[model samples]
Target: MTGPSAVPPVTVLPVGGHGLLVELPTAEAAEALHAELLRRRRTGTLPPVREIVPGARTVLLEGLAEPRRLAEELPHWRVPPLSRTGGTAVRIPVRYDGPDLAEVAALWGLSEQEVGAVHASAEYRVAFCGFAPGFGYLTVLGAGYEVPRRASPRTRVPAGAVGLAGAYTGIYPRSSPGGWQLIGTAVDTVLWDPERTPAALLEPGTRVRFEPVDSAGTPIGDSADPDIPDPDIPDTPSGSREPR
Candidate 1:
């Protein structure tokens, strides 16, 4: 039930012909606004809109019937801090054998084993979805872990690669060029499946926990089934950049 002390100020701007972009001070504030909008829409109190997109520090409302009025009213709306409970929980088993594990350990002043333990110990939430269709920008709750990207971007970061950049962690949905610091590989985690109901496994507000597993797929310090089906890796590369 804990939340932010005060609601952050929002600046609503017009986007093209039928959109209003509400910019916030931080990603958490933006998520709060997005959650509020969704709640209003579900209650039939919000105006009709085609899409509501949450970004790093902004929420984009597209296909609004009254963009101008909505833009004016958005500034006055009190957006409560995002609730961290009652959301879909996803557990991802990760193999901490990434190429940049040693580099990340050096940056965090911890051993490679400690790095995995620290990462798996924290709970993360999907703040937003961007970079790719299935790629989600996950923020650690009550944690300030930050890491710099690679000096030179990789030509092709394989699918399932778990990486960190800035204050977020993301899994690559497909092979793509990226600069995020890779720390592990999500085992048998299918981020995007066209045939699935929502396609993206992780969405905004989804709670996630990374479970560290050995090379033989045994969970560390726990006994549980890790029989999730592996996703099919495509040869074609996606065009989206790494999540910031």
Candidate 2:
């Protein structure tokens, strides 16, 4: 009996009766697969699409009338040239003032200004969005800056708080309980704008940059965090970063 699980690189795993998790080798591969699947859904090549949640190394395709049928079409999935080529670029101006900035500097062996310089100088892309609506996990394009999450999460993290955990950086779209090491905060861009059409300002494959800005939206000057004792990070990237 040839079931839908027969494929070359894809491995289908059941996520209850209503969902299916498609596993890929790397984070980039999963993103590429999600992009392709989204393209298929948009062009009516696949069945009525439902929730398509992409993670670090997996894509969740839920609410399918028949996941097995969709799985049968898996091996043939492909992304077009233009969709793969161009991405939406967005620049988010931020203030390099966070409670955990000192610790991150201590861990990475850099001053606060140096920390801000290192961060603002990098080109990051939305690798995946999770944890909350509008919260996109950004990936550093070049030699990545890796920082662990807080050993013990804070009771509450403010909205627009820019943080780093694992190999990814992200902005808290709203006030929420979180543990990611806060590095900065966005100036003006609305993250999860429910009034807007798409809502989330960031999406997978979207190019992003953290432009350092001051209170009046002018260019920021150098600064450093005071020395403090703080430590703790999840063992893996997408481990236990859930709000509780």
Question: Which residue pairs show collisions in model 1?
Answer: none
Task: Write down the lDDT of every candidate, Cα atoms only.
Answer: 0.81, 0.75
Deviation in angstroms for 194 in model 2? 1.3
Which ranges of candidate 2 are over 4 A from the true structure? 1-8, 76-85, 141-144, 220-244
Provide the global lDDT of candidate 2 against the true structure: 0.75
Evaluate model 2: give its TM-score: 0.80
lDDT of 2 by residue, 191-241 (tens): 998899899999877878778887678976532222421222212222212
Question: How many residue pairs clash in model 1?
Answer: 0
| Model 2 weakest 10-residue run by lDDT | 229-238
Any runs in candidate 1 off by more than 4 Å, and if so which? 1-7, 141-144, 222-244
